[model samples]
Target chain A: MAEYKGVMTYCEIAEGSLPSISREVAGFGRKLADDLGEELCAVLVGSDVGNLAQDAIGLGADTVYVVDDPLLKEYQTDAYLSVMEKVVRKMMPRILILGQTSVGRDLAPMLAFRLDTTATLDCVGLAIDPGTKLLLQTKPVFGGNAQATFTSDFCPQIVTVRDKLMPPPEPDASKQGEVITLDAGLDPAAIRASLLKRVTENEGGVRLEDASIIVSGGRGIGSAEGFDQLQELAALLKGAVGASRPACDNRWLAPNRQVGITGKIVNPDLYIAIALSGSIQHLSGCAQSKSIIAINKDPEAPIFNYADFGVVGDWKKVLPAFRDKLKELLPG
Target chain B: MRIIVCIKQVPDPQASSSGTKVDPEAMRVIVPQGTPPVMSPYDENALEAAIRIKDAHGARVTVISAGRNLAKPVLRKSLASGADELVLLEDAAFEKLDSYATAHLLVAAIREIGEYDLILCGRQAADTDAGQVGSGIAEILKIPCITAASKVELSDGKVLVERVVSDGFEVIEAPMPALVTASSEIGDLRYPKLKDLQAAQKMPITVRGAQALGIDAAGLKRVNLVRLAEPPRRKTECRIIGGETPEEAGANLALKVKEAKLL
Candidate 1:
């Protein structure tokens, strides 16, 4: 444990740039390393990703390790895991942080297992205990009805944090750091999984994370066509459309459009829930919205408890009038 | 093809919050009286994935579940849905085993069950929601693992999986004998026919304990659960818009939105 003396953030690159989650974990990793009076580092693994070392330094990592390889162009489990295992074995950081995305969720647990350690995934909060120097991982459980904190008694404590949960990294452009390049040691035979292709099928619209207002529906939306109605309203307001887990499970909405404990978290200026009963699972994602409005026939729906405004009616009847009024009131 | 689907029985997530309550002091949920446990929803999706593969190709589907006290009737749904065999890994010490221990036990059971080509599991449990065991089991078995798969297609002794990413889905390919964690995107489990359900109830189940698997479950926990508590409450009094009709309510709701300067 004494040999593992620093914090390491596993940074991810998307479309030739550092994603928001990479910056966030790096920022939070700095605080953890500082608290332990240890160094902070970042591991950048991807093709042509070494150029971001300065950005990593600016983001608070004292040292940046670059593993540049063409084979690492896109994420493949076998290749990424081998690279991560090599880096961790070399750096031996006391704490490892990763973003809770498709990659991290797949990699962290396997990496931890390979190293004979444990990892806490999808953490909403992380803190270093002052007295015992333990990294406490706080996460939601039981469909977000309950919360639990966990601590690992192992080296290189790994945790995958839910994206956007932490404040963004404030880069100091003037900051400088050490950069080291490592070779993954070519062995194509070692990689088992191959990426066939990545398909992007998201409907053209304002991304929910970037939208200021979101029009969301639920089981009551009925069909894909019903979601189209919500999408029209979302377009009218220059917002995005989302749905509860039921709608996503029913395939009425793309799985990515699902907002709940198992889906993406969004915090917009306003969230309009149409015929969706706000279960704790669903609220876990959008409860942080500035204002929530619920339109449901069930006056006793749990959504009303957390909503700022309620309209007890069928959305088919209520939505048109509301959309029509908004069309008349607002200038595009 | 030999596909093994891992499932777990949990307090029905569809049940209202009133059906279950968290016991902060004891660090567990108090199951409501008379509410029968259901297969974790994602696990049902996993079983559905297995059945679909079996439907498209000639394969045998075996369902394996590990827990302290698993309900036979709830697990029988897997058989009714199309599983040919049911294997239950049960023991007193299996109740609170960590993800690694759970995976280790499953791996042992997989080993004992002999030949297998592909393994499937839910993305995460509805109760604990850790989502680690499937990946851990894959790691221990040294096989490629694809997590959060929406569609899995088999061809030429390999599997092409469409997995959900942040913005969309990506296609990944791995050799057979790999593991996949299915998500809701795979779609809901099929409702078994009444005749099938009746036949499943009469099927024999193979039950194994920790001693049979040669694992000391009590010694496998590596992480400490510090405490459990209700998540911070988010509350506000909802102001209901009044109107003579539903259409009027909609018009009035829009006015409120405008008043709030939200649009």
Candidate 2:
């Protein structure tokens, strides 16, 4: 067995900028590295994301490895995997961490299989076992009904942490780190997959991760028209409009707007859930929010158990008046 | 064309949490009361994807599952749902195989089946939600793997897939013998007619074991669940608004939200 060394985090870039998950994972990786008495590193793989190394150092990484190549501009599975495999083999990190995004979900498994290692994805909690020095990865299973902790007796324990579970550490601008640029050594011919084009869909006004306030609707929303009301309220508050799985499955809202275990996990300042019964799956996603408000017609809805404020009534009648009251209270 | 679709049966996810319990001693979940084991919802989507492909290209669809004491009714339901054949990879030792071992076992079964053009699986099993086996199978087979595919088609001898991305969807082209993990967006599974259900009940299903597939099940586990417990419960006491009508509750809730500074 190869002797394990340090903790490394794979940084993700979106829309030509580093997503908050990169920093969040860095903070998380920093803690794990400190506990293990090893170095913390970050791998930035993109065409021109080299400048991201400084920010990564500020966030937590002591060493930033860059794999800059034009062929790596857009995320293609084979291309990214090739670079990651090379990096992991060279660094021999004891632990590897990634964001539980679409790309990470696809990449982590393939890499783990290739490395002859094991990975736990969409993990909510991570800890170190002082006894054996293994990563204790906790994630919701059976749709958040129960939690299971897994440990891998292998080098490079790979884990993909759910977004927003931990806040990124404060960055000191004066902090310095070593930024090393390495050749991706990627040959386009060796890659079996190629990106023909990229498409960007127009999501609702605010991105789920960046929203401070969110208004979410569920099965009780009735139809696409019902979501329109929720959208109006969200727009007024300058927040995002999210939905439970049923809302998206019914095609009343876009799949990306769904907020739950199967959807985007959010931790906003305040989450206003309307007409949602608060299934364990949906609650698991937003459980980290600072405060939650539930509005449903059923007085016995499960959402009430986790909500700070509850209202029992028809959303159709309640939403309009609530929107109007909000318009009155915060006149812009 | 020959297509293989893998499916797993799990407890219905929609079952109320009140009946769900965790057995820390066994480090496993006791299925919620009154919830029968059913085909995983996402696997239904995968089966639907296979049926659609078969319908389009005049192909044969074979559904395979690796588990312990595989239920007959559940596998029969899949057959009624348009699968041309059913194969059960079972063993008492196979009961607790992780995703890695599961993929290896499935790969061996596929190899024994001899010929296949495409393989499909659910994006993730609802039980573990590891979402790794599909890609793992693809890696061992040295085939291109696409995940979260909402749409898949056999186009000019290549697999054309529309996979979901964070922002939107992307269409990818891969050669034959590729693997795809179907997502819920693939559309609803087709309901089998009464006649088909009756016929499926009489059809012979093939059963195989780890010895038959030449895999040592005990040696393949790369990860294991160390402990299991119910997630910590939220400790918020919901303050229900007192109101005579929906309008009254709405107004008072707005005031309360304002007081909470959550508006």
Candidate 3:
């Protein structure tokens, strides 16, 4: 057996705090580390994010590694990679976990490549094989038609977990842990990419992952007006409005709100899929939701196969009436 | 300037595999008949990005791929779509490569190209959906990598790109001789004209095997597929609402959903 040591998680800082996905990953990684009887460590990299290091500890990291530097204020691959590679080489943890965000999706593979290993991306389920003591990474394969479990032969196994699948850890303010700040030796001349500016969409402060209820539309919604109705319903319920890949591909919605295999994986308490034919890829992402209600005109749509309640009707006529009924029923 | 685009051939993603079965003995997914394989959609975006760069600046667009039993029509379609040259790396031993091994082969082929100002690839492959190869190649080649690039433009000896993020998009500028993975926002792939399609048929394709590249044919296996099985199906006795009109059905559904307290 390989003598791997600890469980390390990469905690990303966005808007001066850890994103919801990082909190979920840390929660899951903490349990896995405890099961293996190993130390739980968190890696945080940014300009002035030492405070987030303490937040990671409160969320259950035993040791928090901090790499604070001005060059790392914005995430450039080389600068962050330089710090992470050194940390991994020095610590040599058994398992490396990361949130499957755009940054993680890009950095994990490069780190695994440098370490001569492979990674499992967008994994939905994870468990340890009791006999072999290996991480069993389960992910959707073949465009989400089937599921595949993969294990790496390398010592430090790398895994990128999907967002909204795992629950976020409860923070304990009184928890104490060790924090170590390392010298980030980055040479500005060696970095090739520079951040010019970041442009963000005004999404009204609602993120898809944190919402408990989601009302999603698909291409069958007919036009942008359909999404407007869906948004009205979502607003009434105080939930987020999501869309399928086709809707995003058609520019009916922003790509950020897409929920499917290629987009965000959501685990809301209730998922209302409207005018969407449930493709395997789309189902795989939302499969873990507690309850699902599907609405489509076609009775034979695959969505009904997995939906708890199915309504067959044209969205144009149905959505407006549904909204009116809901408003009437739950008048504040 | 020379631009290299790496494309992959995958089964059509939109094809429903309700009747498809897994060949556990061979470790392959058997697609339903009549669903011809096409270039992965994001890779099509990558090719389009390269061609657009070539159109803006005079550059040669060379497209490359690594797979077994390379399809002629698929590879020719890329050339017809505007790639100046095509290179296919095929071998029996290359069948079960993980991202690491695939990146090794691509980096070798790219090194052979000798002179390239930029390399482009899809954000992720449609089949495995593992988006590791592009970053792997960039890391091995010691070049900068910009991933999930929705828009790419060539400037004076540098490239400016808009990358998709969780919140929105970030504009990044990188020096020449870098790699970028294209997202669907790059734009729709252009259709080849009749003359371009005719010229693509006459264009020569460079094919290489493991032996041709001085690699051991039998020793290239790195990652192993442990098992493949159907995911546990969600069994639900769906209670479908039936009404004379869409409005009636919608009103009933709202009442039912409200009764269930799902909202």
**Which residue pairs overlap in candidate 1's backbone?**
none
Query: Which prediction has the highest lDDT against the true structure?
Result: 1
Worst 10 residues of 1 chain B by lDDT: B13-22
DockQ score for model 1, please? 0.80
What is candidate 1's lDDT per residue for B180-245, written digit by digit as tens?
999988988999999999999999999999998899877888989988877887778899997999
Clashing pairs in 3: none
Q: Each prediction's TM-score against the native?
A: 0.98, 0.97, 0.95
Tens-digit lDDT string for candidate 2 (A51-126): 8889888988899999999999888888899899999999999999999998999999999988888899999888
Give the per-residue lDDT digits (tens) of candidate 3, residues A41-73: 999999999989889999999999999998899
Q: Which candidate number has the best DockQ?
A: 1
Residue-level error in angstroms, candidate 2, position B254: 1.1
- Compose the digit string of candidate 3's lDDT tens values, residues B1-263: 99999988887777644655677666677778877788988999999999998898878999999888878787888999989999999888777577887888888899889899999999998888889889988998988999999899999899899998777789999998999999887877899998988889889999989878776634544556777877678888889976789998888888988898877
* TM-score, cand. 1: 0.98
Model 3 segments more than 4 A misplaced: A1-4, A172-176, B16-18, B23-26
Candidate 2, B235: how far from true, in Å? 1.4
